[model samples]
Target: MKKIYLLFISCLAAFILNLILMNSAADMPVFFTSYLNDLLCMPIVLSICLFLIKSFSRKKSIRISLFSAFSLAALYSVYFEIYLPKVNTRYTADFTDVLLYFSGSLIFWLTHKFDSPKNIQKTT
Candidate 1:
């Protein structure tokens, strides 16, 4: 429940921040601002997906989920680097952007790995 709440809040903030960046005088999408958009959205989206995936099977501990989530994020970041630009002209492949994505993932992984329910027994 807490995870879901946090994901919603963060994703909403990211979207709002993206909107804010776009509507500013720059008059361009945030994504066009040198990975500013990726830096904002990657963690929210990836962490949510990773949380969802981890929730599917409760057999794994928080550490495993953390590693898996970050690993998946890294793999997907690499995937985007190799495939996204090819799929669309609006995007160009960039490893540095992927680095930002991985950083976000790692942060979330650590947060959840240490504090997730897997580490606690619900009293209720």
Candidate 2:
């Protein structure tokens, strides 16, 4: 739980920094301005979602499965990259963004953990 909270806060802070950099006039690398947000998106969103689910279900052991992470990545890719681009001129499809989304999902899957009692053992 502490790890998840820390991960979420760190990711959120990165997001805020990215937003500030996006608006700043100082020259920045393409990765910072363009791809950092995409890379951070899923971990932040999924962490929040997981927090809500845990709160409502009151299950400390619950975690997001890999399949669910992949499904979410696919859904986000379809909507943000494929569908939105077709409908809105402001949005353009980027395959790299899709990949970054999946990468973020993987990060969430790997880092989101709950320190449940079941995970601990009595030692002599």
Candidate 3:
């Protein structure tokens, strides 16, 4: 239950933040626009969610988490690509957005290597 709640909250936070970025006109910091945003937040959120689930429950594969991360990110892109542009007129879909989404998911997977608490402990 806690895992579910955590995942829900984290993903919700990411989704809402993404939406705000999509809608806002204020100038974002350079890092936020310079392709590092994918590495910073979304991946961290997903990886932490994966880490939390592994910490809480049965040891399962990460395949499901990766798939879910990719799916959710892609779905978010597609939805906004279609709707936001139609509704807001200010939002436009760029191929770079798709690239960023994929990069975010990939980074999320890459961070999974460090997701295990067992690895965080000193073995010797």
Question: Number of the top candidate by lDDT?
Answer: 2
Order the candidates by lDDT, highest first — what do you get?
A: 2, 1, 3
Cα miss at 33, model 3 (Å)? 3.4
Q: Which pairs clash (backbone N, Cα, C closer than 3 Å) in model 3?
A: none
Give the alpha carbon lDDT tens digit for every residue of 16-67 in model 1. 8776776785767445556665665555775566456568857444343455
**Candidate maximizing TM-score:** 2
lDDT per residue (tens digit) for residues 20-86 in model 2:
8779857888999889999999999888888787688755567787788778899999999999999
Q: Give per-model TM-scores.
A: 0.64, 0.88, 0.50
Q: Looking at model 2, which ten-residue stretch has the lowest summed lDDT?
A: 115-124
Select the stronger candidate by lDDT from 2 and 3: 2
Instruction: Tell me how candidate 1 scores on lDDT.
Output: 0.62
For candidate 3, the 10 contiguous residues with the lowest summed lDDT are: 115-124
Collision count of model 1: 0
The parts of candidate 3 lying over 4 Å away from their true place are: 1-35, 38-41, 47-64, 117-124
Model 3 C-alpha lDDT per residue in residues 1-124, reported as the tens digit of each score: 3343344456557656765785684777755554454434456556566557658756454333456777767776777666688889778766677677777776655445344535432110
Greater TM-score among 1 and 3 belongs to 1
Best of the two (1, 2) by TM-score: 2
Candidates' lDDT values, in order? 0.62, 0.82, 0.59
